[model samples]
Target chain A: MESTYLFLTTVTIQSSMAVLFATLGEIVTEKSGILNLGVEGMMLMGAMSSFAASLYFKNPWLGVTCGLITGAFFALIHAFFTIGLKANQVICGLSLTIFGMGLSSFLGRFLIGKTGTRFLIWHVPILNKIPLVGPILFNQTPLVYLSYIFVPLIWVLLYKTNIGLSLRAVGENPTAADVTGISVVRYRYLATIFGGMMAGLGGSYLSLFYTPGWKENMTAGQGWIAIAMVIFSTWNPFRAVIGSLMFGGINALQYYFQASGITIIPNYILMMLPYIFTLVVLFLINQTEGAKRKLGAPASLGVAFEREL
Target chain B: MIEIKVKQRIAYPKITKFFTPFFALFFALLFGAGLFKWVGVDPLKAYKIMLSGAFGNFYNFSEVIVRGIPLILSGLSVGLAAKMMLWNIGCEGQIVMGGVGATAIALFASPYLPNYLVIPAMIFSGFIAGALWIFIPAIFKAKWNVSEIISTLMLNYIAIIWMEHLYFGPWRDPEGRGFPGSAIFPDAAWFPRYLGTRIHLGIFIVFIVTILIYILLNFTKLGYEIKVIGESELAARYANIKVTRNIFIVLMISGGIAGLAGVGEVAGVYHRLQQGLSSGYGYAGIIVAWLGRLNPWGILSVGIIFAGFMVGGDALQLNLQLPSSLSLVLEGALLFLVLAGEILPKYKISISWKKLSKS
Candidate 1:
């Protein structure tokens, strides 16, 4: 029973890491005046690229790096349309999603029926033995710990730093930012690309570490879930961590319960638990005063910024 | 010798709008050829194969038109919503609910209704289903000022899951040998064929709807109000256009049209609800609507062009040993290029010739 509990907790922690990385990445992107509807596609590309690389290189880190680059490449396309040319952010994002879906599907067809080397955590002598917390915290892959570190890093970067201030300024009013000697376009492009890289890394975590395998549409709708988590968290990176964990926990619990064969709830309904939770969270957030303050969202989010119209 | 002089100030043309798409298409094809080369396929041969497959046979041509019908309908849905500055991304969900509504009527109400009555009932059911699906987001936006983008998108997943549930469980056809799909509709419910081909009356319906929507957008009071609202909500409010009411009405209309596309898919083509009922037509409609600049007539033309891409992609898949995704890549590239191309006409680029020569 102790071994089983440890195994379950380990799975939960790893899955939660995936959610954490994706949600936090999306939070940054949305806060930069760019709503990336293509998160799903970017995630899929990352998953496939990372998986393919890991198979070829026999190293998970290489795979993860490749995933990040793949994500940035696609984000470049998004930036070109949305920031460079001032196209509709939503449409460009959607096009990126469709394009990514097609590209990933095509690539995945070739990668199908192939397997990659699985990633495993090296036990840290004393670190792996400190009871419940040890296995959950220390005896995990480097990416898992990095995801935990990212929450605070993102918080500081978004709220406490000079670069963050300028990023926020661009998001709030690009014209004003430009007037103030800030390159609004440059900041937006950077923020969007950074967001894409994080999303890619999150996808790599799924393929390279979490499930440690390749499958078509493996990211499924996790990209969209990350998007929802951004809203549910009200755009706070810290809160985003909690929201993602809750989602990850709910998702993990459903699978656990189904595996245990409790025979209480139907599996299909359990599958829908996360989405239902998202809707409830959306309602609660909308009802809250914090939502009115708009503390977390970029003011110019989703609006096209034209320099001289 | 002919000489072309570079002007110091870029002279932007307002009437070159027509040429922009052509330029964009040319560049898109050029990019597509480069991609083909990357994949180790001969671009010229692949292009020939794709074109012939899309337009070669009579049956294939009919299929393109048949596919274009739903695309046109969905494109009109998006175009109409855009005119009001309402982004209806839930057209996919609306289309699904529309299919469900039409299916519910065909399966349950067709037994007691006359053949003439069935078609109208199905169409109405579809419109109602689509409208109902979008009503929640519309209400949220109108009342609470919530972002419809997020709400409508979230609702899309719900509709998709709901659709999967119906097909896989309660609505599963008993005669389908365990396939997760609904029963095929009765012959009385099937749409009439056009010109002895597999193409149905749905194409004609799309054409009629396009013309009607063009009239509604160009000549009607509601269209004027929508235009005002799109231009400036403050101005529309000052003019007493009932912004909230119009928002609700326009969203419902957009949803209804999208639903009609679903109805066309089920009643006109499939005759039975299946798992993959829509091949992203609703999502693709967003691109079509934008590409057409939200004009109803333009929606029709772009819709057909998009359908051709879909058909050509399938051809590439079958004949050229290429993945169907190549078409998607080409389509996306086309959208990006077209958007960029359109921008050039609005804003001219001026280059410093002396600096260029120095470089």
Candidate 2:
């Protein structure tokens, strides 16, 4: 029972970091009132690029940096589209996603079955002696600890600072914010690029620490799960962490359940849980009368701000 | 630092419309060539091979049509919904369900029923199944104002999983050889072909769907109402058009048509219900719809062009050892460039005079 507990805990946190990073990134972007639906695309680009880069550079950290750039690069196109061209955000985002998927698949062709330099495991020096919690909580990769710090750091950044307030103001009421001297375009671009970069890191995590081998669409629906996590958390960075862990637990539970030899429920049906859970939660939150969703959603989330020059 | 301003065009020259698509195509090809170069393949050689493979001979044209048949249905599904401003990215899900429906009819009812009844029944069941798949998302969008984007996207994953559950469990072939696919469909259920080629009766079906969509969008009140709704939902309500009902109808039409693509694939192409039934036709349909600008004839043309990409991509795999995913890259580049180019005709750009003062 103790072993099972440790197994589930370690797996949960490991899986959670990828989604946690993505959700946090999206939260920041949405806070600035830019809705980016290209998380999956950006993540895929990040995953493939980082894996390939790590393979070439022989350093997982450098590969992760490359992923950050690649993800931001994809988001740059999206930024140019919605911010510069004033194109419909939904269409441009969808295009960005498809572009990412295609590019990743095309580029990842030779990288299949290839492993890369991975984030090394570490245990807290003195904390490693603690009972059940020690192995689960204190013993983890560096990135996992970084993800733990991000929750509070982002929470404070989003809630405590003037920049956060201005970002929120821009997303909530761009015209009013514009009158008050905040540049909506700049804030949105920065927020979106940051979001894209985090999503890339999320993908980099998948390639470098979580799985450490490249395959076609290795990120699968995790990017979507991260997006769903953003909504499920009601745009709170801390809440987003909890949501990611929950979804991550569910993902890890699938493997656990399979290994335990449960015969009644099949694998494919188990696979449906995450998506169905997302749908149910989205429906519940978006019922229009839900107070939580109302408070969390940016006022002008997907609306294009056409500045009068 | 020069500032740019956009002015909405009141009226555009007819010639500009004709040139925009060609320009988009030219740029898309250029972008694709650059991608090829990055992948260590010669751009000119790859393009030459691709063009030849896609349009080399009568056999290649037939293959293109075979591949295009589903894309037309998938494109129309999206094109119709896009007209009503309903973003139905669930065409992939709808297609999968349609395949299930058609496969059930083909496998179960084909032997029991007359040949004439079976084919039509499969088609009808496929449409109904597809429509049913999108029903919940439609209601949520119409009544509750839920974002159909995530809902529809989620449904795609669910549908694929559901399909996998069946094939891997109950639907797995038991008799002939312990395969993953269902039993080969009965002869009576097969889509008829012409001139000993793989091109099925879907050729005629494609033409019919294209004509119907064109007429529906161009000559019908529903089409006009869809246009109004897309342009402005408040304006549509003011015009006394039933926004909720139109929303539902649009979804049903979109889902039903997309399902037919599944039917064409199963009854025509694969001849069985199995894994890999949808090769991203659902998602690719969106690209086709956008590429075609929601025009029926344009959808048909774009469908064929995309189909050519698929066929040529296969040829690339066989001959040059290039990955089939190159086609996906090409498609993405085309969609991106086309989307960029689409703005030019509608809006005019001008240089701001007092750029220095603004800074």
Candidate 3:
């Protein structure tokens, strides 16, 4: 019984790490004033690319790299349209998503019926031997540990550094940032691309480790969930960790409950818990004035910036 | 060449406005051709197959119009909502609920009512369901300033799950032999088909709705209010337009129109509630709305064009051994190009010597 509980807990943590990584990555992108609806497309592409590369190269790390690169490639297209051509951000983002979905599905049709190379969890010798906290905290796949590390790292990059300051400045008031000699467009382009890469890596983790296989539309609407996580976290990476984990936990609980035959609650309602939770969070956050002030987004987040004549 | 620099400063004639979209379309086609070529297919042959497939036979051509009906309604929904500066992304959810409401009436209520009464009731129910689905987010935005984009999008998942639950559980047809869907509606509940084709009276309804929306938007006071609000909320408020009420009204209308699209699909085409009923018509409507520049008449033209692509895509899959997703690729490319086209008209490009040298 204890072993079963430990195994279930491990699965939940792993799944949560995957969601947390993706959501945290999206939070950074939204903070930079670029709303990337293409995360779903990016994740799909990443999943396929990583799975394909891992099968070919026989190395999961290489697969992760391929996934990140694939995601960055799509983001480049988004950046060109929104940053270079000065298109509507939301429309451009959605187009990227549609394009990504179509392209990935087309690719996957050919790739269907093929099994992906599986990955196993590796642990450090000393860290693996440590007591209760160490197993929970330290003993995870390298990708999972990387996700935990990214939270504080992203926080520092978004709040403490000069580049971070400029990113926020550009998001809030691009004209002001441009006047101060910062390249607002350039920063936004880079930030969006970086965020896209992170989202891609997060997706690759699904195929490479989480489920260790490929399925059509497998990421499902998790990409949208990641987008909602940004709002739930109030645009903070640290809080996004908690929000995404809770969502991941709810998702995992549905599966466990279904398997356990505790059938009082309908599975569909349980499946919908994350989205319901997102709506509730939006309500709560919007209601609180203090939360609104602290978590309020940049003034010019979605507005397209053009230099004044 | 005659030196044309005779004291007059000539302004470029906004040629970019017309040329940019052409260029973007050209490049998109080029990219698509490259993709096809990489797969060892001749680009021209593929295009020929796609075009001929969509319009090859009389039967195929009529199918395009049948598909265009829903596209027009959903396009009108997005176009109308955009005029009020509301991004109604939850059209997918609204469409689903619309189908649910319309189907419910067709299954349960149509038997008890007269034919004339039943048809209108289904449509009215669909509109109400759609409006109610979107009402929550609209109200949240109006009262608490929550982001409608997020709310509407999140609601889409809820709507889809709800549909799946109904189809897979309680509403599952007793005679379906384990298939996940409701039973077909009675013939009285179905829309009237056109002469010797699957095309239904819904096409006529779309045409009428298009005309009505056009008149409403261009000639009515409510239309003027929407235009004013879209241009500037502060200015509209100062002009006593009652921005909140206008927002709510526009969103409800938008959701209702979107719902009508779902009703048309369920009652006219499928005659039964199936999982594949939507096939992304709602999202495609967004592209149609933008391509039409939010003009109702424009939506009609763009809607037909979009439906042609869908039919052509189906053809490409069957005949050319190409992926059907090619249509989506084309649509995405068209959206990118059209938006870029809109932007080019507002700005003039100049080649400055200093900037050129710096580069």
TM-score between model 3 and native: 0.93
Where is model 1 more than 4 Å wrong at Cα?
Answer: A1-12, A122-125, A289-291, A304-309, B1-11, B353-359
**Native A-B interface contacts kept, per candidate:** 0.37, 0.57, 0.63
TM-score of chain B of each: 0.93, 0.92, 0.91
Candidate 2 residue B211 Cα shift, in angstroms, is 2.6
Q: On residues A64-172, what C-alpha lDDT tens digit does candidate 2 reach at each position?
A: 9999999899888888888777787878888888888888988888898887788889888878778777788789998888887888998998999999999999989
Listed in order, each prediction's TM-score against the native is: 0.92, 0.95, 0.93
Per-residue lDDT of A1-309 in model 3, one digit per residue for the tens? 766566566667787765676777777777778777888878888888888888889888899999999988888888888877778788887888777777777776766766666667767678766776566666678887787678899999999999889888898889999999999888888888887898788779988888777776778777877877787788788888888778767776787888888877789998778788888878887887455656757777777777875
RMSD of 3: 3.6
List clashing residue pairs in candidate 2. none
Candidate 2 similarity to native, TM-score: 0.95
Lowest-scoring 10 consecutive residues by lDDT in candidate 1 chain A?
A287-296
lDDT per residue (tens digit) for residues A93-133 in model 1:
87888788777877777887676875788667887788778
Query: Interface root mean square deviation of every model, in Å?
Result: 2.1, 1.4, 1.6
TM-score for chain A, prediction 1? 0.94
Summing lDDT over every window of 10 consecutive residues in candidate 2 chain B, give the lowest-scoring window. B350-359
Sort every candidate by TM-score, greatest first.
2, 3, 1
Q: What lDDT, from 0 to 1, does candidate 1 have?
A: 0.82
Cα shift from native, residue A32, model 3 (Å): 2.6
